[model samples]
Target: MKGMTIIVKTVSSWIKVLVFLFGIYIILFGHLTPGGGFSGGVILAGSYVLLLLAFGREYAEENLPLPIASKLDCIAAFLFIALALLGFIYGAGFFFYNFLQQELMADCNAAGKLVSAGAIPLYNIFIGLKVAASLFLVVLVLSAFRSESDPTEGQE
Candidate 1:
């Protein structure tokens, strides 16, 4: 299956970019708002899923090939772990010890500013990356089951 109709492809083309950007916004400003890494990550994955649905498996894979997705998955996992390890070396000898200082304002209120969030935003970004890549890969691989089980579903 290549895709649905031109309407779906066009609408999804616009929606996917917006969804991806909104996911980034959520990850970046998570500490300032209610949303966080998990939510943003789901949204990000949804954008790719939208692509997969609108353009089919092959098109989505072409857009984000397996090698690239795998590399991203590894990089994100390593970076997230390395970030946590920093707490042991630089923090109070504990894991995730909030080593980074929160940026305070002149009035002594740093509640919702982007810089005021300390390592939370960085953590959110890493989590978002990892979650997105992980989910994308899972969906991609699970989709394989559909074809393998039927054998003639995608073949004409």
Candidate 2:
């Protein structure tokens, strides 16, 4: 990478890390807080965009590898849908709240805490992963194809 590219990459990588951490925090505290999977996923995707802007499309593609990201996205989507469907087996509606009365469960307040909700937390995780991965992959792939035949256009 060029010196400018290196600087951009470093700063962008730090931003991405911060964005990822914020996304995790949002997802974990989603039940008790305002942000959730969708918001966090958008933030996570923002990191990838930063990377693309800083390093160029080729760098992002080489690092993220479109095929693997695609597969992960598919699997995450399937798992999310499956989890929603699982509620039907317990006589609950789709995406219903079916609490497990296990002793290992965390204590919950009336308004609910970060660890209070059962499936909600798990669902947020799934949605977060799916959204982040999918958005990252999508942006990467899109950037990969954005070019003119000149070849020197994105050389910086």
Candidate 3:
């Protein structure tokens, strides 16, 4: 009684997976590609927003509880900061310097390899997670509060 039609729910349930996967792909390959953490994170949050719209706030919250999302958001932020700070200790006097890349560059074929980007991919991953969780939390919180005129305001 709370969500959209059955057809919408079914379609969204299927499509959300693809959306999520695409977001991950973007985040992972962002060092070589145009789309990066921010864009991919928006896409990831959009997948959950689709679920929210199709299945209602209760169902969406059940899928990704506020507590879990909040934890992930905080953890990702901390990890990102830690990773940046690590550069200060290991690099040539800079933050976010690619120390790992220097080690890998010894190999002639490491130029375009997935792992060759060193800290970039890790940064992208953490940023993607943080952005996705933050955006989802904003949407979920905004949707949680019912308006005075909501039809279900007094319902059990």
Candidate 4:
């Protein structure tokens, strides 16, 4: 009653999972593929946006509350900064250096492994989280606003 019909809700529920998975895939394999943190984060936020559209703001808020999203955004930012600064502590002597790559270089051939990119993947993960949370918050806030008469009522 508060949102679209049951058919839309059910379909959105199913599709959201796939979208979320695709976003994770993009974030994880971004170093190898074209899509990365920013694109994947947008895709991730879009999954929640689809839910909000199909199930209403209240339902979406219940699943991912504003406070939790806010905290996630902040935590992700801190982690990204920490990852960058870790290079300094590890004698990389530069911000955003590939410190992990250096250590792994002596271990084995990292030609096609997941850990090959090292800090890049970590950065992507944190960046993906931050972007997803930020975009979702924006859409959620925008969705909260509504005119009294309803925008669709007086239209043809």
Candidate 5:
């Protein structure tokens, strides 16, 4: 808010919006694309950083509270681990082979897509959520602390 002039602020605001949209796209397409979990998470966090850089740390914190972000991170990680454990109950042998066997596999498709592999897709989604939340939390916490330490500065 205080750092950038009017022209810079306008351009940066647009950039932040674009970056945020890109991050969302990455997270949603993670299941079908090569970028899953970690990559998408980092992209999401990067968008937050962009917002901080564009506006200020205070703005970022106001938009994404640390407490909420922390809770999201914890929940995402717990869900990922729980999903992995659930595989055992299905006789999958602890994240073991995650396909529908040959008969069901053929019914789905000739060779079946990646998502058709069952637990693997679920795990990917879980990991993606976990990583995104964790990364965002880390960035927000660190940025918050840094901002508090230096009152005069706008953002890093």
Candidate 6:
């Protein structure tokens, strides 16, 4: 019902930050590489899951409560939609067209650079946030139900 041993806690304390950072990196560089929003989202979700496992459900909930997770999930999705819709204004009515395609930057269109991708990084970030929150919320709710339904909460 609670967290794991001290070793797990210590290792995870360091690992979670690396994983979270990697998740963001994946999302940011998704367009050029293989990973994308979905993969990065799953990775981000994994970071929260790591926190839950290492710090217990109570701590996880304190760090990312259900209400805040739900609100962030919805907001991220809405922001993604709004951003996509903005392409219509600059993309000639296209759904997800690159509005910032040819603004004459220094070298954004280079083959293998972080800023080469237009709107893709933003999309990945939003989707990653949405998915991370949704996954955390689901896991937390399920764990709550599981804890409540357990037959040995206070029997010991």
Which one wins by lDDT: 4 or 5?
Answer: 4
What is candidate 6's TM-score against the reference? Answer: 0.92
Scored by lDDT, the top model is 4
Clashing residue pairs in candidate 3 (N, C-alpha, C atoms within 3 angstroms): none
TM-score of 3: 0.90
lDDT of 4 by residue, 1-156 (tens): 168998998999999999999999999988888999999999999999998889888888998999999999999999999999988877458887878777655585466676567688899999999999999999987777652346773563
Model 2 pairs whose backbones collide: none
Candidate 1: RMSD to truth? 2.6
- What does candidate 3's lDDT look like per residue over 126-150, in tens digits? 9999999999999988786654457
lDDT of each: 0.83, 0.71, 0.87, 0.88, 0.67, 0.86
Worst 10 residues of 3 by lDDT: 103-112
Model 2 segments more than 4 A misplaced: 1-6, 91-95, 100-111, 148-156
Clashing pairs in 6: none
User: Could you tell which candidate, 2 or 6, scores higher by lDDT?
Assistant: 6
Clash totals for all models, in order?
A: 0, 0, 0, 0, 1, 0
Worst 10 residues of 5 by lDDT: 96-105
Answer with 1 or 6, whichever has the higher TM-score: 6
lDDT value, residue 89 of candidate 3:
76
By lDDT, the better pick of 3 and 4 is 4
Clashes of 5: 1
Q: After superposition, how far is residue 126 of candidate 4 from its true place, in Å?
A: 0.1
Q: TM-score: which is higher, 2 or 5?
A: 2
